[model samples]
Target chain A: MKTQKYIVIGGSAGSFKIIIRIIKFLPANFKKTIFLTLHRLKHVRSGFVEALSLKANIPIVEPKDKEIILTGRIYLAPANYHLYIEPTKTISLSTEELVNHSRPSIDLTFQSAAHSLKDNVAGIILSGANRDGAEGLKQIKLNGGFAIVQNPEECQVLTMPTAALKKSQTKNIYSEKQIIEFILNCK
Target chain B: MIKLDDIINFNNAVKEVSSYNLSDYSKKSLGRRIEKILSDYKMTIDSLIKKIKLDSNFLEKIIKNITVNTTELFRDPKIWQSVKYRVLRKLKNKDTINIWHAGCSTGQEIYSMLIILHELGIANKANILATDINTDVIEIAKKGEYIYKFNIEYIENFKQAIQVNPYNYEDKIDVSFTKYFEIDRVKNLMTAKPFLKNKVVFKKYDLVKQDNIFAEKFDIIFCRNVLIYFNAKLQKRVVNMFADVLSKKGFLILGIHESIFGAEALKYIKHGEFYIRR
Candidate 1:
């Protein structure tokens, strides 16, 4: 019943639009667990889970600290916390010092996902204003996981995808629609 | 190229040299922490292996950095609200109340509890034991001060928890932020009021090892955000220890997101976000 082993997605400023678009198309019965980490301002009230759950049929959650990671749902990293995936398949949250000036670091999540899920995972980097997720996607590739980045030209902010291109060992450059296609065919 | 095997071997060496067992920790997060140390010291994996053998302090450096000690004051206000209204409310009539703030890193949670007790008029009748695995954080926790730049979420959480009239609540907590906290605008830091500092007795206690540091059983045990570092087996064992140290009706409060997932979970009944041994 593995739709995909696991999906690790990273984005920053302009990511939700593409993320929502992809979520809109995923089946309610999607089998893989999706972990999303986005850069956000510290102390912003969390409406992220509610907001992402609006059009997405699958269950979306801002996971609690030490919460079990379940399949067939999406887990969003709470603002101002670093999310780490454990080998026991649970998620842990920490208030450890911010990296790259971002607390919900894309690189940290991606890197953790790379090791925990290993080659059975796929790393997707979407639109963002910063270079936070580039090194993370590189980690995914190093661990033999599938690494894909949105085309920089198609991005609202090209810095993130362009940096991923320079930093990560990815050959799959996807556009919004192509990214949707990749997710749909993930099994 | 750094392989997972290399990290595993390093963890094994760490265990052999120092009784610190990291084998159960998630390799990915462990790998990243190791990588961070390597980069910070500008040493390769092999170089780290050599340095680990050559240097005794190297392992402690990794331990200090790797343990997630980062937490803020009044974290997860909803849980605090429950502690006040549900857990503490039950013990309000007691002559004396005792609390164990396990893994009380930097003392934020302990101080927050003291404030609640103060507001409840039980601060004088309370005994608080705050302990952490890291002595460095224990020192800071003893000081009872924190960074001044308050996270807006913290303010919001605090606002929701205080239901009494705002002025009366202020009057109840007469010291206020101004008196208890010496906020330095230029330094952007806040120092704890001496009163709160006096309430807590801090000690260094590791969750991994079994010890009878405190003979008295606690009415409330607040161990939040510390178990995530442990694997399922360790989490189970520690939860049992928490059970051992807690009174029969005493409450075990975990971080809002933390759940007691293993069979040891059967030991307690879930009461909202907390667990109670019935």
Candidate 2:
């Protein structure tokens, strides 16, 4: 059996457009499971998934706690909750204290993926104003998983990618096009 | 920087030394929480295990810390709104309302329900029982006091769930904070009024244990964010237990971000934010 692949993408601030672009480019049969954790207004819960689903070829889900993880789908960490990837390949949500002033914390999701999936995981940090994903991407690298960052120069807000790059040397610092191509070519 | 092996060893140690069984906790979160404990005590996992074997009091403390006690007043107001209009309204005709706040942390939720019941004129008919594995939180729940400054924002939740009627824009009631709890801003304290505090019976109950010591079926069970900490098997078991303890057509309310899945999902019908026992 082929090893399952998992991709975790963390973004905040100016990363929404980049996420939409990546989703638009992926085909309906994308095999790898994708987890997206973005900073969102906690009170405004209804629109995020609907907006993402409009152009995505694959199913986009805001999973509830302990929901089974499935391939060929995109999971968005719901607002105001931290998302954790379990060794059982299930998603667990927490209303624990916020980390880096955000819930659906990028670091929490990325770290959980790195720990649970190990070498089969890929952690990507995108345009954002904060340093939430820096330590998480570092964990991904330490766990022998792929760690990629959006090229800071190409980002609307460079702080996130720049912080990630400074925390640990990532495998790739790619533009949006390169990022999309890398995902598309994943087995 | 705890490894998976360390977590496993710790879980084994906990189970062997105490009645608590932590093997079914979700690994990632459990690992993270254990890491925090190690850092807090500045001890290695080996030392922690050694301590667990030596002192039962320390073991109790460790278990309390392991269980996440993060809860707030009307943590998700929309669910409480549904409880008011959809759930409690339907139960109004019942001779008595039996409510179980499973895993009730620090008692804000119990008080929240009391306020709602009081507003709905069904306070006298309600019997509320709140439980948690953490004895410290049970004490705090019994006290019904919280940090006023920290929870000042949740006052809005009270307004949203109690004062505003979502279906009718113009239908609104002015409920002062004083009616439910006294806000002593100067002392940084918010204490639940006696009527709300005295109505609830608090107990220390473990969800992982199959025993239902309450010996009574409930009309509503609010487990909320508790199940997110458990692995799938444990979640299924607890959900099944809730199903058994619930009266026919009784409701099992979870956190806004929680849901029932797998074989256990078959036991209840999804009703908006809650599950109805079929």
**Each candidate: what lDDT?**
0.79, 0.89
Model 2 lDDT at residue A153:
92
Best by lDDT: 2
Q: Please compute DockQ, using alpha carbons, for every candidate against the native two-chain complex.
A: 0.54, 0.65
Q: Number of clashes in every candidate structure?
A: 2, 0
Interface RMSD of 1: 2.3
Q: Highest DockQ: which candidate?
A: 2
lDDT of 1 by residue, B128-246 (tens): 99888778899988876666665435444555554433324453322344534566777777777788788788887777766788778888999887776666778888999888888
Clashing pairs in 1: A64-B257, A65-B257
lDDT of 1 at B36: 78
- Runs in model 1 deviating more than 4 A are A1-5, A64-70, A85-95, A116-119, A142-144, A169-171, B1-28, B44-59, B150-157, B163-176
Assign candidate 2 its CAPRI class.
medium
Model 2 lDDT tens row, A43-84:
566688999999999999999887889999999999888998
All candidates: TM-score? 0.86, 0.91
Residue-level lDDT tens digits of model 1 in A31-149: 77888898765545456678778889899998876677888888988887789886678787766678888888998898878877888789899888989989989998998888999
CAPRI quality band, candidate 1: medium
